[model samples]
Structure formats: structure tokens, C-alpha cells
Target chain A: MICGRTPDELIRDIEGFHGFVAPGLVIGAFMVDLAREHIGQNTEADAVVETRHCLPDAVQILTPCTVGNGWLKIADLDKFALTLYDRHTFAGFRVWLDLNKAKAHPNVYNWFMGLVSKKDLPKEILIPAIFDAGRDILSVKPVTVRAEFAKREKKSKIAVCPACNEAYAAAQGTPCLACQGKDYYHTGS
Target chain B: MICGRTPDELIRDIEGFHGFVAPGLVIGAFMVDLAREHIGQNTEADAVVETRHCLPDAVQILTPCTVGNGWLKIADLDKFALTLYDRHTFAGFRVWLDLNKAKAHPNVYNWFMGLVSKKDLPKEILIPAIFDAGRDILSVKPVTVRAEFAKREKKSKIAVCPACNEAYAAAQGTPCLACQGKDYYHTGS
Candidate 1:
């Protein structure tokens, strides 16, 4: 079982939430479950998803952490890992699939290492293999969130951009992001 | 039509990728299409997604830019907007739903303003309203990406964290993120 449900059941839920059963979601379920086991159920927790892909969706489905709620932050460091910590204490567990250990599990390694393309992936075999290997292929490290990173930024003052006539964070100052040279389009001549 | 596909056709594709037809995706479809029309075809492009939600998926579906390719960057500034630019010139269009204009379309206004909860949303009505409103509720601005922001960060040197025995960007300096107190868990006593 993965995330307290059988792999089949979990896949259905993941499909409903993530559109398709991403291998990252399947693997992330194991990582999340392992971290939660270490943290226990009584404390308030927050998450730091280290990537922007399917792993963030896994955290959203398995934990209270979500992008909209500000409890989850996607750092996009390009690591297929995450940390779940006590909101009050800023103490948490970091979990990642250990590539070295995954070598023993060819299916997991193949997917993680990009040995097979998505269209050619054998999902039927991959799902069960992931469930069987479970957290055996993961690495966990205890960590404390940095003080500077833990503190939430206060709401900044708002200002209207002179160029676009739209409101923006006054802290960014002057014109607005579009006018400040971060625009994505040029006005047609 | 949204993104050169009929609403029904687009919805099916979106369902396969994003799980559901989010109103933001529907609105973002109009926003992305408008931006594309301004930029025209046959140009190398990159995108900066101002938020970390459905809009990025819309860009991924409609454009060649994607996070994996470093062509799309999700800034997560909490704005429901995006910028698509010429890769070489960094000149592009900024597109966002104008709240003031949205007031005329109740469904669009309700969703953007959070006047109704997701479970209670009327998808049958909302999808049509978005198509009818199209780019009418959107505001566009021509922008040039700031030189600093446009440049990609070079791959930094790698170092092993003394504390955690894990690899991290050497540029972050000493110990690594988990060792530097950016950790999410504390070691058990």
C-alpha cells in the first residue's frame, strides 16, 4: 500500500487530482509517507517541495500543505525531494529517493534516471514495483528551517504602475514589472 | 476557440494534463492566445509565468516553453499573469485578467474574486462565459525583460555538505541548505 491506500486506490485519487498518475507522484507518496512516519501525526506541519513538477502535487494531496495556503513552498532547486516540518518549531524531515539504492530496483531507477520515455513506460509494472520497494530506496535527513527563510514576509505597500496603470507591490518600486523591463510582449507598432 | 482548439477539445486535453478544467486555465487560454497573436509565429520565445498555478500549464500546452527546458520560469509572485517574449530580444507581451473589466462577466468575476467556492462552481456555465468574455477582460502591456532577470543563472559549482553529506550548490557556501538551517526537521535526540 502507498499513502495508506492500495496502489490502485492511490492511483485513482492521483488521477483525479493530478490528471495522470505521474511516476513522481507515485514515488513522492512513498517519500511523503516516510517523512510523516518520522514526524508523527500530532504536530502542525509545513512543506518545502524542492521541485515544481509532480512532487508538489503529491504533497498537496497527502498533506495539508498547498501552494494556495502558503504552507508549501516550491523552491525549484531541481531536486526530486521534499521536507515536512513542524510549523511552530521549523523542525522537519527531508526525504529523497536515493539513486544509488534505486539501482537494485530497475524500474524505479529507469524512470528516475530517464532511461525510458513516458509513452514507453510500463505503468502496470512500475506501480507495483514502486509499492514493493517503498521507502527502501529513500534517504532521510533531519533538518531545521533557517530563521530567515521561516519568517513570512509582511504585506508590502501597493502602488499603481505609471506605465500600465495597474497596482503592484510598492516594494518593487516604479512603473511595475512590465514597465521595469520584465515584460513578455512588445506593443505592436 | 481557445489555443486554436475548440473549447471541448481543449478541455479534454487539459483534463489529461491538469486533472480538471480550472477557470484560470480557461481564462489563461484566452490570455496566452492574445499574447501569441501579438508576438506572431516563427520567433524563438521564452515565458515568465507570474504565478505558480493553472496559467503555467496553459503556456506549456500552447507554447514550446517549459520549465524543464528553462524557457518558462514560474516566479510565484501571486499574480494571475504571464509574459511571453522573444528569446533573443526579450521583448514580449504581458497578459493578465483585468478585475475591473471582469465585473461585466459575472462567472469570470466570481471565480477570480473567489465569490464562490470550487465545489459549488457551475462548470457548465463558467466555461462558456470564459469563451464569450475571451480577451475582453484582459489587459495587455508590451514589456522587455530586465537584462538581469532575463539572463539565466549559470550552473554553479557543486560541493558536498559537511554536515549532511549531501550535494548542494557550492555558491550557497558551506554545509548546504539543510546544514545551514534551511532544514525542515531536527534530528531526534
Candidate 2:
């Protein structure tokens, strides 16, 4: 074949094909379908695939050299780190696949990715070693929660959405009782 | 979204697709493009895509898991047996891209595919992989080769159709022949 670049180059290029592959599972497909529902195409296996709007940010698998960093950096990619183990080897591409699936979960993908950082590995070889032992697909799930979250009081006990802390609403009870007592009149007090 | 089938049914039905997340790089894109190309809606990506038509016998990756063997198989997808390196992974997918490119340049892609197949972990992996890897819309060129063939018999030396491998005739001996011993024929054979 009249190739203009090396095979290595081709492999790397494929990794750069962005805005194409989706990360969500069934929900992802539903979203894709929803996004394209009006278009009315994409019905067959070979339909013109229209990407979903505003889903999880894309992720990238770093090369082998950067793998030793232990914990992966959660950044613009909006990713999470995860682990996978099967009957056979521990090291292989399976690690990346598992992390990828998790990242798509929204609830857990990012949460788990936060846990596994450089601190987890002593040798920092876990990442590369796994990718190095390449398997077709990662056939494992995310890490299990060892300890259950403690039950806490709810909005019924006290209304929240306090003033100033727009990110989190305060529990309501005292004062104006509009925004968890954070009314403008009660704000200064 | 109001999906046609229940989530459980969708999970059990679609061949590949997890809940809402998509997996793999370019795989989904490739399938989407394939659907479009087949239906004649593929347009925009044509500038970057280098495609060719090929008729290959469809092969299966997994089977009944009983007495009957699978129709096709691809050795582990990694480039090497040591670790799960992204650089080493996806060998099976690469073969498909190679095959489509080969089909375009009938004389060349095949010979080139054969060259790389020699180094593959297991010889058997080549067939299934070459099919599974599928076609590619290369962002750029990745390979080029120079082949020099030396033919012994004059009757066999012909200008053949590179796409279809059809043979044709050229000039007769002495009238256009520069030498008495060496000659070239134009034959589809």
C-alpha cells in the first residue's frame, strides 16, 4: 500500500479521533437517539451517527511512559481512575477500558477516578503494566464501596439552598425560612 | 428519553453498547460511517476519509461455547504479549483498516498486510483481525513501500490492473524490443 506515514503514526492518529466515540452505555445511546430523534436517521447499524450533546467530557489514555505517575490527573478530560482484575494477568489494556466505562457512569466514574492516584502504587507500574498486557476489552466493573454512607438529615428537617453558597443550599429552619434563613434582611445578622 | 424497548431489553438486544456510555475509539465512528456509506449519505468526512470497497466473508468473534468452534478468531488484541500497551493494543482493529486500504490498491495492500501478519503473535489472529479492524478514514498517511519484481519468463511479464489484478498485452518483440533476450507482455493473466 502507498502509505505516507508509519504504522505507529496510524495507531496514534486513531486515538485522536474525537467527538466520535461515546462513553455512556445504554443511557448514552438513548441520549444519542434523543439528540438525533428528529433527524430520523441513525436507525441502522450503519446510520450517520450524530453525537450526543453535553454528555461527559471526553477522556484520553496517556502513553506508557506517563503511566508511572501513579494517580491519574483528573482534568479537562473529566475522567476517573479505576482497577480491574480477571482470572489471569493483572497488567494490560484492561485497566484503561475499566476506567473508561466508569468515567461514563456520571455518578461513580468521576468519584472512583478521584480515589486512585499516585499514592496507591508503590512502583507506579500498575498503569503501564496493565496497558502493556493488552486484552480485547476490559470485562470488569468499578470498585465496590467497602463502607456504606451514613444516613443524614434531609431537606424535610430543614430547608436548604442558603444564600452566598450558591453551590450548596443550607438547611432551612430559622429566620425568613425562604432560603434556609439566608434572606437578604437576615443575611447580615 | 422514551426509548422503544425497555432498558433491559436494549441491553440484551444491541450487539455492543453498554447502558449509556460508548466504548472504544473510532470503532463506533467507523460503524456509523459504514452505515452512511452503504446508504449513500456519507459526505462531509470524505475529505479526510480514504475508503475502498471490499467484499469479505463475514466472520464471528464469539460462538456457542460448546463443541462447535467459532467461525473466526483474533489472537489477543495487544501488540505484544508483555503488557497492555495502547501502542501494542488494538492489533485486531488495525487489520481491518489495512484490508480496506489493500482492497483499494489490490496489488499493494495485500502484500503489505502479509508483511505485517508475519510478525503477529499468532498466525491465526491475522484473518479474523484483518476483517474486524475494518476500514479507516485516515487523518493522514501512515505507510508507503517500494516493491521490485523480477520476472523470468517473457510471457509472464505483463501490465496488470492494480485494482482487479486483470492482465493485458503490451508491444510484440523485435519491433519495439530494445533487446533480443528480454521482453515484456501485456496480459490480464
In angstroms and one decimal each, the interface RMSD of every candidate reads 5.8, 30.9
DockQ of 2: 0.01
Off by over 4 Å in 2: A1-23, A41-189, B1-189
All DockQ scores: 0.14, 0.01
Q: Best by TM-score, which number?
A: 1
Those runs of model 1 whose alpha carbons end farther than 4 Å from true positions after fitting are A1-48, A51-72, A76-80, A83-94, A97-163, A167-189, B115-121, B186-189
Score candidate 2 by TM-score against the native: 0.16
lDDT of 2 by residue, A38-102 (tens): 22232211111111111211111111101111111111111111221111222211112343333
* Candidate 1, B129-148: lDDT as tens digits: 88899889999878787756
Q: What TM-score do all the candidates reach, one by one?
A: 0.62, 0.16
Sort candidate 1 into its docking category.
incorrect
Docking class of 2: incorrect
